[model samples]
Target: MARIYTPAQFGGYAAIVSCAAVIASVSSLRLDSAIPVVPADDVSAISRLALILPVIVAPLALGAVALLPEEINQLKSSFADGAWLAIAIVAIMQGVTAVTNSLCTRRGDFVLAAFVKVVQPAAFAGIAWLLVRDLSVALATSWIVALLVGTRAFRGLGLVSGWRDSIDACRRAWRYPVFFAPVSLLDTLTQALPLLAIVSIFGTAGGGNYSQVQRLIGAPLMLVGLAVGQVFLKHAGDLIRASTPLTPLFLRVFRNLVILACLTVVVIVFVGDWALAVFLGHGWRTDTMFLILVILPVVFRTIVSPMSSVFLLYGRIGLVALWQVSYFVVTALAVFLGRSGASLDYLLATLVCSEFMMYLTYFLLAYFLVRRVDRYQLGLK
Candidate 1:
């Protein structure tokens, strides 16, 4: 799909998709994280809380966009047509999917959770192949349909229970979303804001290249991180509930991730350019320097990914949220400093620095949190 489409077209699609993702993330209120931490009895309620927000917020957001069509157009000229409608649909779908995925995770039904993860990109690739001529619509429609299908799969699992339980559940878990929603929003913004800035300053083509590089380097690391993180979250939550000492578990996971990160860095440093040329094709090929620049941040992310669950496990959402805000601020500042031209070197450098800072902060925070947990368990405090 990336190869078939020009950078401008791909960039436009990427911008809209990023915007929809930001909206969805905000509407979700981070209840997905809460699902695993909250009591099993409150799972139904949290799921309901997840559903209610999107239902209420998506429409209001769509209404705002509809009313301020000119403002939206100014923000992204690609959204000049009825593209905003597609964005709205995607946002709503994403919100619903987040809730459903969380419910599946809480229920320990990783099969369903994993299926939901696979369905979106698989559907997008298939749909994009068929609609090769119109990449924007293809991408939007793919997400809309995939998310809807994934959400529907949870129906048979009895996630909602009933209208009465839905209301009661929301009441019980109200605090989780209220506290975590802003944290989730800031985290989502940390990701989306940089892409949005790149698109705004460098146009869709620059955004396209940026998005592609992220897809190439970030995707592999994210896949491994997500799988490990999910298992870590589930296991850690179980241990906490069982009153088990988490110091050993935390140390084991940390050591394993460090080993994995070392191996990943070595592989990318040696063969990254060849791998990129072979997999992404000659058109996507770049000099080894650029490839190195791209992989550096991904390396940081690789190390940070496994430890991300620690923040959620230890009730340090505020610290994580503050770090996300700092990330966005630094990224935006870097973009402003380099806005003179759309230099890939400049953008990559900025991104690499920002990602390193954010990941490093996370590592330090996780270390302190783990030490605190260890001390408490040993009666040192």
Candidate 2:
């Protein structure tokens, strides 16, 4: 796709997808997070809540994006020629896919959840291969189709019915958005800003390169992290409900993730350059390889993936919110500093530093909180 399309065109596609991701994250209203924690009887209602909220929120989000000035969109490498319609479609689909996937995971249907994760990239790759002549349409169509397919897969799961129950579910869990929505918005912004900054500072070509490397490297991490995190959260919730000690399970998960992360880093260090050349074509081999190397240190912190669910289990939303805000500030500052006469390498280095700092902060905070909670519970016991 990178070879088929100009960097600006690819960057435009990336910007649209990134914007859709942010919108979807906001419209989800964090109802998905509550799916596993909420009572079994309320699961269907919560699923309905998830479906209803996005229908109400996505159009407003689309309107807001449509209202942005053309020049601003151009600077961000976004599509300004009515492509917002495609973006709107993708955003709504993404929100529905997220909720349905969460419903599957909460139902202990890990196979379905994992299949949903696999569908997007597989569909995108297949479509891009088939439509090599038109990368933009291929990319947009891939997302729309993949999300629609994934969402529809949940049809018999009883997630999308019962309007009255959905409204009641919304009323019961209204506070969910209070803590999570803002944090989710901030987190999405934090993730998307770096790509936008790359476009603004280094032009669309830079943004394209950055986005490619992000997809290449981040995809595996996302798949593994999400699968493990879902299972961990489900088990953690069960154990918490049973009043069992969580420290042992947390430690075991942490250890396994550490082993996996270490193995991944070792593989990347040795074969990463070769893999990039073989898989992504020769054009991506150099800069992408170097960027991968630069960010390898940050990959170590991926061991803390399960800690997120730990926070949710303990209802430490305040801590999670604080960490997210702090991370956004740190990442924004890094981007600002990188804009000051820095090369792409330097900018990437700053990103690595920012990611390392954020993950380190999270690990420390989660560690302390987990220990504190364990102690309190032990005292009560």
Candidate 3:
């Protein structure tokens, strides 16, 4: 019998995403706080290299990494020499850590995914302590260890499939990037634009603060959203392919997401600063209002988050690209122009504004697309 979704599964998924969020948030706290202290410019450079890497490196690295077949030796070797080799190494390891997280997530095992993700930051901290004196090595080792731990986690979960086969599956999933790339770019810009903008004003420290907020709110959003979104996407795809209707499923998930977002906002408003103080320390923590504002986009995201699944379900890459680009452009411009003053409040407000724009834009587009699809199916188009 197929495994039924249960409270245990929910526990597992939540545990996984929460854990991942903790690790991510804590690590950001450390990195943001650590960057200013490194004495040597070269070490700082190396550390900064580690930091600036994924902006350019992640996708290219992901592409190369995903293209390989499931040979362990081959995958390892390829990862060693790939572009942004260091970042690639980190990505590989992090990918492993997230494997079980992703699997459980796809299986509607939210708790498990959350539980698995929590280990990531702790693992990094442990490694960072070991190499704390060498900033570059510490930075590199943090990710490396995280990946090692991730691999072990995947192994423990029995999700460690052959690299060759994993790559093969990814190869088939290649069509996704056509749509995923642009959306991903827009996403990176939305989250990372503040850092870029900060270069003109307060330099790295300002960028670091912005990055921290982005990491704090954005990372959790992705993790939590990913957990639910994966399950929803898979179900929606299956239903679409089976010629079964999907509106009920979409609506139910959408409502649940909205309810979740409301609760999240309340928590962020009430305890956000206290939580940040405990987790990120006072040095890296910002205003509660700023955090609250940063979280607004998540509400919009909850509504339109599943739209890409619709795009992928119908293989509507062109429409997805167009809709996503429109959202991206509008949001980027709004955020860029809005970055005035050094206050986290202004920064977050801008970020939230951009997110809201994208949310509304994507939601409307997805709604219409779904409606059009449904009408066409009923011979009413």
Candidate with maximal TM-score: 2
Candidate number with the higher lDDT (1 or 3): 1
What is candidate 1's lDDT per residue for 1-381, written digit by digit as tens?
A: 656777777777778888788778867666656767776676666666677678678767667755775545455465547567777878888888877767666667778777777887777778777755665566667767667766654554354456576567666666556767776777676677767877877777777767777776777777777777777788888887776777788778778877877787677778877876776664554567776676677777766767677777777777777877787788777667766555767877877787888788888888788788878877989
* Every candidate's CA RMSD: 2.8, 2.6, 14.8
Q: Estimate each model's TM-score.
A: 0.88, 0.90, 0.63
Tens digits of per-residue lDDT, candidate 3, 1-381, equal: 001222222222222222222223222112221222222222222232223333444445445535666552122221222223344445434433433343343345656555546665555446545544322233345655555443432333223334453334334444433445555445544544444444334444444454555556666766667667767765776677778766677778777877877887888888888877676553453677767775676567755675456765676767767766777677667656676545646766776767776677666666677777777777886
* Model 2 Cα lDDT, one tens digit per residue, 1-381: 655666666666777778778888988798977887887777777777776677779879878876788676555334556567767777877787888778777778888778777777787777877755555556567766666766654565465457787778777877678898888889788888888787777777777766766577766776677788888888888888887777788888888888887777677778776776677674553443465744453464457755677887788888889999998999899988878755877777787788887887787887777677777788953
lDDT of each: 0.72, 0.74, 0.51
Which segments of candidate 2 are over 4 A away from where they belong? 6-8, 70-82, 151-161, 285-289, 297-301
The residue-level lDDT of candidate 1 at 288 comes to 73
Question: How many clashes in each structure?
Answer: 1, 0, 30
How much is 221 displaced in model 3, in angstroms?
3.4
Evaluated at residue 254, the lDDT of candidate 2 is 81
* Candidate 3 structure, TM-score to reference: 0.63
Instruction: Identify the leading candidate in terms of lDDT.
Output: 2
Native-referenced Cα lDDT, model 3: 0.51
Full candidate order by TM-score, most accurate first: 2, 1, 3
